[model samples]
Target: MDWLRKLFSSPVPLNDSYHLSPSYKVFTSAFDQEILAKDLERSRKYAGEPTASADRTWRELQQFWATDLALLQAETTRLAGRLQPSLNLPKSSTLTLLIDHSGSMRGDKIQLAAFVAEVTVQLAIKLNLPFEVLGFTTVEWKGAPVRDLWSAQRALSNPGRLCALNHVVYSDFTDGDHPNSLRAMFLADLLKENVDGEAILWAVQRAKAWSAGPHMVLIISDGAPVDDATLFHNDPSYLWSHLHEVIDEFGIDPDVLLAGLGINYDVSSLYDTSDTITVFEDIHAKVLPLLENCLRKM
Candidate 1:
């Protein structure tokens, strides 16, 4: 598995605008499907600690956000006490946030995500709901390493998803009670390409395994899937089409309730329950209402 990770994890130069030619897919190779084994699907995915030093990144958030976070905690406390119990989640339900850590989420978007994380924690605590804060991004900028590996094997057209899938457990269930768990969202370096379809599928699969009766997952992202490595080799709509398929398949399941939050991006196309993506500039953004709307289905 370490070898597999190395194959996909290595960074290399890539052409951003590379797209498949009409003839590219006409010709196929044995290596077209994957560069390695049947297990690349599992081996290429990572969900663990930040590649950077945790202590340093956590302290960075601590120093920069001490006052604001304190205020946020106080506000959440106030809201929790006054809010009607109807706003609380259904009992025995679990919540999970499948966030996009794409490069486009870098500056203000990422910062707001941390704020969202704080709010989610507050909601979980107030509602007595178990939750997880998870994120997804590629290991590197493009699929160059993956492509290079495939080329080394035998160049082929329509090779899907050359980059390593990185799913992050920024804060797992029960960790909401801990102070530093959300700090994983503050790591700027973890922000990279987003493959929303796979991330959503992974989150949904994990959530389904965790609970039988009720579970709610909220996907937060600023944009659609944009992994250059994949789009270049396959159809331009390859990832987007897969995203729609995954959502359409499980979005309406009886046991699971799913909603999407577009961070200033229009994700209404992806999730029928999700409205247009908006920034969390103020309480007026209806962030809480959206969460309430999703959980209401549960």
Candidate 2:
């Protein structure tokens, strides 16, 4: 987890011309096959027997698709070389990431989320993207307000620092419903008061600003927004109003948001590909294209 800063030497072309390592390709193919098989088996059992065990098996598969595969792909990409032909990427592109730390996020679910979040920021750094990470929970501290929140400070150069931040954030709580209200207020203040909304404003004044031109916000959660209504405006049409605030405050067009809805608690749909991976594929398919479109619009 060392960090190196250098110009893109053997620039990769923008036509999706990046190549995968032979070892990586073989490994991923094998892994995909195994996952596909387990998925199929679980589906068959649930289809034939309709038992709770069969249902549980199906849910596991869904979690893997929704979280694990994304992390694996990201980790592989980080280990791989960055593409060149230089898209003139911003020197720093702010990536503000928030992962759920609620008590409910224990066991394999949290493990998977942690893996994905870590791998993703790692890849972003390897590609020389500037980013920040945060974790939240409601578990109280002594003499502290019920809504008190904490965050790992922003780092400018060290990838290991980012990784370290990831570890600290994840380590703070055990698995439960540790949602903190003060965190949201802090985030709002950060967005509104400090950093001028240059990057994604976070809770407190602990904003992560990118030296790069534009920024994006990435959130990984279990569809549980602690202050969902307040975070955004109350209007239903404004699904991502806070996002809009970032865009306006920064005056950056097409600020991107990439989110992975974390593992669902209900186990019934986990093993079902049709119910899970299909949705994931739909979302995954949209990401690259959406980013490309945003870049163009910008």
Candidate 3:
């Protein structure tokens, strides 16, 4: 695997100020996640305003995933309250929808992602389980100030994750955000560079905090982590290794159920359990097995 080759290689050292950039050697702490979330709030000024958050743009968002969403809702009805069948899981089994807001997921992929989120939320509500919808993207397209700071430094060979990341919270179990409000996540301007490792780690922390027992986290992503600034300065596989490092760390946790639903892209190597689904019809069939597995695990 190309990732394996990049794994053993060393990152080109950089002489810049410390920020959210983290090396593969260190473990991500809860404090780190909090700091990053606060940083994203500070960086929101650099990103575009989310009209969907303030206005009723869900009408338009509904159209993108209408076909798939309708089919999924029907399926939910057919299954009734037996989504987990004989499992009889309690309300403690939380569900976290971790969405990738990278530019690569711009068109049909994003629509499919919305459909997936809707289905997950529907099932969670049906089973009376808690659920949350979260997304991740950079504040700036090119990673402005972070990149600028690196340039001001010696511009060394590698600078990890120079981008100013912006993590999103559309809905949470506290009921702070309504289901309709999740439409804000798929806004066009919100699509930017994605740091998969950072987003996944963030979601893992939140999901763990919400649930007392087993928690299922479905990560919707199209491809590997990609940030021009981060890649240009660091090793080609900097983010890739980071993602694996994070996944491998948490993948073994028996209390956390994790799976990746790729957008027409097979992510078996990236995740312990993953499946691909296109925007075309029959998405529900492909996704059902993963959801079932999560239930069984509980």
- For lDDT, the strongest prediction is 3
The C-alpha stretches of model 1 lying farther than 4 A from their native spots are 1-84, 87-91, 174-176, 275-280
Against the correct fold, how does model 1 do in TM-score?
Answer: 0.74
Q: Show pairs that collide, candidate 3.
A: 12-158
Model 3 C-alpha lDDT versus the unseen true structure: 0.68
After the best TM-score superposition of candidate 1, give how far the Cα of residue 44 lies from its true spot, in angstroms.
Answer: 19
> In model 3, what is the error at residue 81, expressed in angstroms?
2.3
In the range 19-46, model 3's lDDT, one tens digit per residue, is 1334642211111222232233334542
lDDT per residue for candidate 1 within 19-112, as digits (tens), equals 2122222111212221111122223232234423434565676578777667666766665565545554455578887778899987667766
Each candidate: what lDDT?
A: 0.64, 0.32, 0.68
Please, what are the lDDT tens digits per residue for candidate 2 over residues 1-298? 1111122112122211111111110001110111121233234422343344334543555466756466556634634353424355565445445555544444444544544454445445555555555554321212011111111112212111000010113211121122222112111111111111111333212322223335554444443323221222233322233334443444433344333333553212211111111233433343334333333332
Better of 1 and 2 by TM-score: 1
TM-score order of candidates, best first? 3, 1, 2
Model 2 spans > 4 angstroms off = 1-75, 78-82, 139-200, 203-212, 227-260, 265-298
lDDT of 3 at 295: 69
